[model samples]
Structures are given as C-alpha cells and as structure tokens.
Target: MEEISILLLFDVLVGLTLVWLAWQTLSSLDLFRAIVLFIAFGLLMALAWVRLNAPDVALAEATIGAGLTGALFLSALAQLSASTKRKDEENKIENS
Candidate 1:
C-alpha cells in the first residue's frame, strides 16, 4: 500500500508538471524561452511514458521530441537573431 501511494504521488506530480510546462510554453512572450519550455515538456512527457511502462516510446520521445526538436529550434532562433542584427546594422548605415 505504501509503494502504491508513492507511485500515485509521483504520477500526480508529473501530471501537474506537464500541465505547468504546457502553460509556460504557450504563454511565454519570448520565443526562445517558449522553445526551451517546449523542450522541457517533451522531456517530461518521456518520463511520464517511462512511468507508464512504455520505455521504448519514452526513448524515442527523448531523442526525437526533445533532443532533435530542441536543437532545431535553437538553431533557427540563432539564425533569426543574426539576421535581425544584420538588418538593424544595415538600417543604421543607411540612416547615417
């Protein structure tokens, strides 16, 4: 019974955390921050899958959903920021 209660508690915590991460990802104003939160949510989802006895799914989610997706997001964000900076510099030169 004690072990069961512990598992139940863990489940509740993971559920609440997933909900919180989802909210953070959606409501964040900063795109980079939203991306990070999204990655975190994916990782937490992997953990949830493991707890549910789906280790194979969990592994896939961790690698594809969190790792690959997060890398893509960060790379895209970097490119965007770089382009924006270049545009700003060009505008300043034109004004000058």
Candidate 2:
C-alpha cells in the first residue's frame, strides 16, 4: 500500500509537470524560449511515457520530438535571423 501511494504521487507529479511545461511553452513570447521549453516538454513527456511502461514511445519522443524537432526549430530560427539581417542591410544601402 505504501509503495502504491508513492507511485501514485510520482505519477501525479509527472503529469502536473508536463502540463505546466506545455503551458509555459505555449505562452512564451520569444520564439527561442518557446522552442527550448517545447524541447523540455518533450523530454518530460518521454519520461512520462517511460513511467507508463512505454519504452519505445519514450525513445521516440526523446529523439524525434525533442532532439530532431528542436534542432530543426533552431536551424530555422538562424536562417530567419540571417534573412532578416540581409534584408535590413539591403534596405539601409538603398536608403543611403
């Protein structure tokens, strides 16, 4: 009975943490911060899957959901920044 109660507490904590991280990710204004929080959320989601005895799903969530997706988001952000910088430089040159 004590072991069961401990497990229940752990489950509730993980679930609540997942919800909070998801909310933080969504409500974040900065794109980079949002993506970082999203990655953290994915990692916690993987932990929740592991606790649920779904190792395969946990692995997928950690790799694809957090790793690959975060990398893609960061790369896209870099490209966007570069493009915006180039456009700004072009505009400045034109104005000059």
Candidate 3:
C-alpha cells in the first residue's frame, strides 16, 4: 500500500513536469531555449513511457524523438547563426 502510494505520487509529479516543460517550450521567446525545452520534454516522455511499461516507445522517444530532433534543431540553428554572422560581416565591409 505504501509502495503504491509512492508510485502514484511519482507518476503525478512526472506528469506535471511534462506539462510544465511543454508549456515552457511553447511559450519561450528564444528559439534555442524553446528547442532545448522540447528536447527535455522528449526525455521526460521517454521516462513516462518506461513507467507505463512501453519499452519500445521509450526507446523510440529517446532516440528519434529526442536525439535526432535535437540534432536537427541544433544544426538549423547553427546555419541560421552562420548566415546572420555573414550578413553582419558584409554590412561592415560595405560600411568601411
């Protein structure tokens, strides 16, 4: 009985954290921060899947959902940052 209650409490906490992470990911103004939050949410989801006895889903979420997606987002961000830097350099050259 006590063990069950503790498990229930942990489940509720995990659910709440997932919800909070999702909200933060959506509402954040900084795109990079939002992406990071989204990755964290994915990890949390994987843990939730494990808790629910879905090992396959947990594996998928950890690998494709979190790992691959985070990598893609980071690469895209890098490209955008590089382009912005190039544009700034061009403007500086033109001004000089």
Candidate 4:
C-alpha cells in the first residue's frame, strides 16, 4: 500500500511538471528561452513515457523530439539573427 501511494505521488508530480513546463515553453517571451524549455519538456516527456513502459516511444522522444528538433530550431534562430544583422548593416550603409 505504501509503495503504491509513493508511485501515485510520483506520477502526479510528473504530470503536473509536464503541464507547467508546457505552459512555460509556450508563454516564454524570448525565443531562445522558449526553445530551451521545449527541449526540457521533451526530455521530461521521454521520461514519462519510460515510466509508462514505452521504451520505444521514450527513445524517439529523446532523440528526434528533443535532440534533432532542438538543434534545428537553434540553427534556424542563428540564421535569422545573422540575416537581421546583415539587413541592419545594409540599412545603415544606405542611410549614410
């Protein structure tokens, strides 16, 4: 009975944390911060899947969901920043 209660508590905590992380990721003002939070959420989701006895799903979530997707987002963000910087420099040159 005690072991079951402890497992229940763990499950509840995991569920609540997942929801909170999702909210934080969506509501974050900074794009980088949001992306980082999304990665964290994905990792936690993988853990949750593992707890639920879904190792294949957990592996997919950790690798493709968090790893690949996060890398792509960061790469896109870097490209956008570089493009904006180039545009700003061009604008400055035009103004001068």
Best by lDDT: 1
* Pairs of residues at least 3 apart in sequence or in different chains that clash in candidate 2: none
Q: Which is the winner by TM-score between candidate 1 and candidate 2?
A: 1
Identify the runs in model 1 with alpha carbons over 4 angstroms from their true place: none
User: Model-by-model lDDT, in order?
Assistant: 0.98, 0.96, 0.97, 0.97
TM-scores for all predictions: 0.94, 0.91, 0.90, 0.94
Where is the poorest 10-residue window by lDDT in model 4?
7-16
In model 1, the worst 10-residue window by lDDT is: 31-40
Alpha carbon lDDT at 60, candidate 3:
100
- List runs of model 3 lying over 4 Å from the truth: none
- Predicted structure 2, TM vs. truth: 0.91
* Prediction RMSDs, each to the true structure: 0.9, 1.2, 1.3, 1.0
Ranking by lDDT: 1, 3, 4, 2
What is candidate 2's lDDT per residue for 8-82, written digit by digit as tens? 999999999999999999999899999999999999999999999999999999999999999999999999989
Query: In model 2, where is the ten-residue run with the lowest total lDDT?
Result: 22-31
Better of 2 and 3 by lDDT: 3
Cα miss at 1, model 2 (Å)?
2.2
Clashing pairs in 4: none
